[model samples]
Target chain A: MTDRQDRKAFFRELGKYSALGLEMALSVVIGMGIGYYLDRWLGTGPWLTIVWIGLGFAAGVRSLYRAAVRSGKDLERDEERRRKPGGP
Target chain B: MRKAILVLLAVAALPATALAAGGHGFSWFMMLPGGERLFYMYAAVFIAVFLLVAAAVVVGGKKTEEMVIPDPRFTLRNLFELILGFLQQLAEDIIGHHYKKYLPLLGTCFLFILFMNLIGLIPGFLPPTQKMNVTLGLALVIFLSTHYFGLRENGIAYLKHFLGPVWWMAPIMLPIEIISHLARPMSLSLRLFGNITGDHAVVAGFMALIPVVVPSVFMGLGVFVSFMQAFIFTVLSMIYISGAVTHAEEH
Candidate 1:
């Protein structure tokens, strides 16, 4: 690609990645907000809020973890398939 | 050569500069505008930007069918497909076959962070990720999402994952696990906030000094740091998610 085209592509990729990051961040914020509100409603003080909020955060992390594992395994499988004779 | 000359000229205009502009020095949060503090602003900006982008996405989705002009730039559909494919591959590799459900969340997280980090490179913009509140918010989501998925996947049994291998250790192990789980968000937020903030500060500091060939190198480093931070954040999130989804099996 021409230099200008490459630059444009780079910016586009950057924008795309930024969007992804924002989504993840927002999810955490939303989860925390919900946990806090639930705690207030249930009259559990800080304890329940902390616990449920922690749970929400954990759920987010778990999803992220799962994505990583899936990506890694898929790469391995693809590599293995590529190595196999007449695998195409 | 022209770019180098311009950089030098800019540097020359600045007053006396600190010796180590890029060092991880302490940032005074209270000193910011109106004593409003860094974290508070960070939260506000993150929420505002997120809402704006979300609205844009919704509007864009609604207009997907119509094309005003045949522009050579990549179309929204093509971009979405690319992102979907990337996220799908990531999910499938990590969660086995159930990757479809989590794709939207993971994909969105990765793309948003990547752009936020890149925004710092612009001349006048400060990256939202550089602030602790933003990172904290992001980390908090990952922290919560892990358990949410856990409960959804295994119900009450999800809590059992934190109880340790044997019943004897449940009392001690539960608290320990809880503390460690709490630390995840703290670590995630600190790591991102520290790296981006430090890198940006350094770039600014360097440009303030020697006004020569030096700052460009730091700018390159800034780019590298930005990309690495995004990758690490995504990887950690994935690890946490998979752990929650498959918690019951190992225990």
Candidate 2:
């Protein structure tokens, strides 16, 4: 990557990585909150909570996987940029 | 130089250890009740920053020719220009071709959050971003704007991403997408709130322990943290906006 592109990419990557842990944790909390509300409204005791928490965990892992894939692609791009020293 | 840094780090670590022990002593204006305190604090900071920006603009606007020529010395106008220039570059790189349209929002977020965070470094003034409501409010605005721009760009197709690639996967993908989307704002708010509150608390704790030289190190750290948190928030917002606006082309 060119110097400017490299800096930009570094900032973007930093933001993405920093947010990942908090995002995953919140994903679970949001899922639980949604599940709890649905359970309360429908008078289903624990079933919805169970299901939603499961869904939330899945969502958390899914996002982590997506970020992993993105970083992998980014690394590949960086490698390509390195191979062609002068090209942007 | 290494020994000096190590001593600085050791001084910094003392306060952090104090932070862990959980004794903080800092007071703001005691007139307001607990619930409305953050609101008033945020408003005061908002007005102060607004006035500062307005003054800078008015002064800078007075001489149109001078605006073109760079200032010989560091000045408020130069600082503002530097920040805006950096944000412009960031927007261009992250948001791509239509980056100009989003510069105003990104710039506002950067400046507002940066000022709010910086205010915490001053003794007796708490940063509003330390409050959950303030940070969450800011995050929600970014959240709403991201979707609004996405909808404007892609119409109804923007919602289709939530439904996954295949029709059969919609049930699974929809909830996961919703959870993840909701998490973005929550995480944004939480990270800002936690960092500022923690930083402020550490500074306060150190101030209570020893009034003189010790607190300054943590205050310096506070300054760095404030800039970092603000930058991270803006960068994330830019990433989100770019993702929303450009997702259509990729998928």
Candidate 3:
């Protein structure tokens, strides 16, 4: 491939791949944010915050897993197509 | 749909009303002549501009794709193709073939929020998004609309989504679902508001310090942040909407 085309491909992959990480991180952060506030309001003294953070981590990991599987399927599809005759 | 629109507008307008009505007490000094009235008008004006552009695009563009327009000028048709085309790609990328029906809503949203965010970079104007009321308003519309789409797609069985996998966990699961679901809008609004407000403040701060050079730097950053926030908001909204419909396919 040409250098310019390679560079464009690199950036596209970079952006596409990093979005999963960002989404995962944001999920945990959102969980923590909600947990921290709920703790403060309910006077749970960190228990709620702890629980919410845990939930947040679960949510993030769940999203990451979803993303990984989705990308895996896409890559497999691409490979299958490439193995086919007359494929791009 | 009309009633839903009215409700969303009313919810969106509530904070502006309270701010204007109660301004005599706390924010008397900060109040401009028109006050929150003017604050809300910026969004109104954006909506008006959105309608105008859409109308122009609809009129200017040919109905059929076969009609050729090579490198068309900076006309509404070109602008329409550029934005709508990108949004179409975005929706399809995120949600697959289920994307077309949502294009108009998502397209309008991206265009409106992107412009609204950029407006603050210009001097003597505030981005409607900086106000929690406006952000909340946009979020509420998405929140309700996504649920509507979810229910339509999945049937009333969608409520099982709130209930956990095991039936016994419903009590614990429901609240978590509600809070996390509610947090979608909270985060959506606050993230946009916080980023834009912080960016605007820094730009204004720098503009005050050295009106000539430094603010331009912040202005450039504002452009980047504005686009990123718009993108994040749009993509997240798409994810939430699609998740409601396609939960079974993912796992």
Candidate 4:
């Protein structure tokens, strides 16, 4: 592939990953927000929000961590392949 | 023809015995007790099934390699090859070139889900996909996998995709986009869970009440719904992955 095409492909892959990360982070925030508002309306004194939001945050972090670890592994694999003869 | 009629007569009498037995042959999983405990069972079942299938595939592939079977006439290996070939075609069609890299993840998700859905059709078995935890776990994997690809492709600049096109709209668009993004997993998980659960429940209820030829119609509907849910989940995942992999410049 030409440099421009390669760059485009790279960007496209980047966009995909970014969108996924954003989706996950947003899920947590919205989950927490909904819980918080519901608790407030129900006179639950922020307990529901606190707990749900915590869960949401935990879920988000877990997703992010997994993504990071997978990416790291992929990078290592690529590096190893590059070091070997006749690597792509 | 006379023997067939006699067999049909005996088959018709079987349900009476089954009904008289009581309990409907359903295990504890069907009870669906309150709280999130059901989620744990769902996760455990999903993981167990996944591991079992993975191991089977590995062992079966090795066994097939060692076998001296001459003809490729409809064996398990051939069946797997057919499935993998179809999945590869599907991946290429949906995701374009270099789709081989994604075949493992996407194919596994699709097949696992499809099998889980079909499992519900068995008399006593419950489809793990009918539960929220299983669907959620699959959604979580897709969600994370997309980001892993994104960050790997662009490093820190991957975050820029979330900022939107215009700088001013970032404030408003970010939250809206985020809400929609968050909804993807919820929608993915809940849509599969609700459809499968509802379909299975309807069939069970119908079988309980009518206990006759009527439940078959609902069972047909359940079958259709199960396939549709699997298709929807796979298509949506592809869409999400394609959207992530598409370059902002192209837009």
Candidate 5:
């Protein structure tokens, strides 16, 4: 039972981050989209576009970092649990 | 085995015959504007599922001596019970203790998306999920609800995470956070739309080329794709909502 539960948890965590690549790509696209619209609205040629695109790339990296941190913590917790007395 | 193959061939031929009869044109309903068509299809699917569930409830509730023994055969009530139980378990696992409040949203999303995808497998029906507008609309609902739950659960503290760890990093972190949040809906909708559309196209393409015993293989693959996509959408939505509502310090 414990073995099966571990497999289930493994799959759940796998599914959680399966779309990280797409999310990162869309972050950049959405950032550029927002930048383009803002430039049109305020008549600020290309400057805000550059700034927002950079922001979007930063956003993608941030999300990737967050996912890594989360999974790292999960691994640590799992290790701690496994090392406990009578743990499977 | 021979009889089963014959039936499968006949079922596969039905779509072609229907199209030929319709003069190779789409059904009247398909001619409606995209938004209107989506609305009508959703209403139709919603009502059909609601009626089926209501019937299942009524039938399953009947008092009987055999009720003491669990039914071995698959039944409508059993199907729903299985799905609900799965969702409940998923919520409890992901969202922790306060999971019940969100079950309604999660359950509806799973069932609705599953049925919507299954409908596309029929000879003449189109799945709304194959369209960007429909999937985006659903994704937006998830996005908005995540924020709503976050605000309700954590109040002012919810916005603190958006700001960042310290005062100096606010300017840099704020835009990144907003972009990340906006990307959630974009990613969700695009993934579902692309998967369904590609699956549908593959099935249709194979059906046109072979039109024999082979399309069934693709059709089987389509069913798996549909279920997998729905499951993925539900899993991601749960994770997002969990992230939103849970206290940041716990992470």
Candidate 6:
């Protein structure tokens, strides 16, 4: 039972970090697609596509930044644990 | 754009299921988005869901007493309490004190998904979540519900949440928000589909090659994957709901 819980915790950690990369890629693709569709519907050539790409790119960056900062905090916490006197 | 992503994701996610069906579902058939009618995967999913709901209803919420020998079927109340207790702890841990309001949604998502994920582990049955439509449908529900709750909580100002912080960033933030939102369903669908398909395929392959020996090991992994995927999905949904409903000041 304890082993199963341990494994679940391990996989839970794995899923969260792995999802970060996926979020980065899909966000841009989604943005570009939305932009392209809007441009096609409006008969406005590449303008909307260009605008949508920028938004997508920004959103992707924002998400990545948050993940990076979060993981960094996690690292900082680990470091604190290590540096604490009498820490195992 | 979504149609293209949906096809690409569906195809990419379930090549293993195709191999299991001896070359169907996951191949060029998926290119025809609504072509799910050709497979019984959807029906299997509904059956699984129906069974789960019916059982939970029948079981009701009986309180558990200590049992000398704990069997899942024999100790129904114990099973219910264990699952409900775990889910409550998970909800409070992830979504905080306000978790009570969101408990029903999260609990249903977890239980239904856990059921769907487990069905494939039963031989001769294909899980609904193995299909693009099933996972996509779930992703859409989470997406819509989170936004619905968010809007209900924040009113018209909810629209401004997409505008982002600086007034000048509105034009940039809007499309980005839309793209990010679009990506959620894509990511959710693809993740569940790929994980379940991969697990089921490994078990099938082992069962074919060496009977139940190697397959049992992988089946153990399948059980882990089944529970973990459901947990991840529920947690992500909770995070989304909480984020949407949070005050602008917190943002």
Query: Which one wins on TM-score?
Result: 5
Query: Number of clashes in every candidate structure?
Result: 66, 0, 0, 4, 0, 0
Please give each candidate's TM-score.
0.60, 0.85, 0.70, 0.64, 0.85, 0.73
Rank order (by lDDT, best first): 2, 5, 6, 3, 4, 1
Please report the TM-score between candidate 3 and the true structure. Answer: 0.70
- Which whole-number lDDT from 0 to 100 does residue A68 have in model 3? 69
List model 3 lDDT by residue over B135-194, tens digit each.
888889899999998888889778887876789988767655665566567667777788
Q: Candidate 3, overall lDDT? A: 0.69
Q: Per-residue lDDT of A1-88 in model 5, one digit per residue for the tens?
A: 2776587577668666877999899889989999999999999999999999999999998888877876787677677877889875
Superposed model 2: Cα runs more than 4 Å off: A1-7, A78-85, B1-59, B63-66
Quantify how close model 4 is to the true structure by its C-alpha RMSD in Å: 11.2
List model 6 lDDT by residue over B1-251, tens digit each.
Answer: 99999888767745443454443233233344564564445554466668577677645574456334455564655665677778787566445577898888888888888888886776545667777888888899999999998888899988997877799988777766777777777888788889998887777776556552466698899999999898888867875776688745456
Instruction: Please tell me what DockQ candidate 3 reaches.
Output: 0.17
- List where candidate 4 sits over 4 angstroms from the true fold: A1-88, B1-25, B28-71, B248-251
Better of 1 and 3 by lDDT: 3
Q: What is the C-alpha lDDT of each candidate?
A: 0.64, 0.82, 0.69, 0.65, 0.80, 0.72
Q: Chain A of model 5, TM-score against the native? A: 0.89
Q: Give the C-alpha interface root-mean-square deviation per candidate.
A: 11.2, 1.1, 4.6, 8.5, 0.9, 2.1
Best by DockQ: 5
List the candidate 3 regions with Cα displacement exceeding 4 Å: A1-88, B1-33, B50-54, B57-71, B249-251
Worst 10 residues of 4 chain B by lDDT: B17-26
Question: What is residue A54's positional error in candidate 6, in angstroms?
Answer: 3.6
lDDT (10s digit) by residue, model 2, range B167-197: 9999999999989989989989999999999
Rank by TM-score (best first): 5, 2, 6, 3, 4, 1
Clashing pairs in 4: A12-B245, A16-B244, A16-B245, A17-B150
Across all candidates, the chain A TM-score values are: 0.60, 0.86, 0.75, 0.65, 0.89, 0.68
Report DockQ per prediction, comma-separated.
0.05, 0.77, 0.17, 0.11, 0.85, 0.48
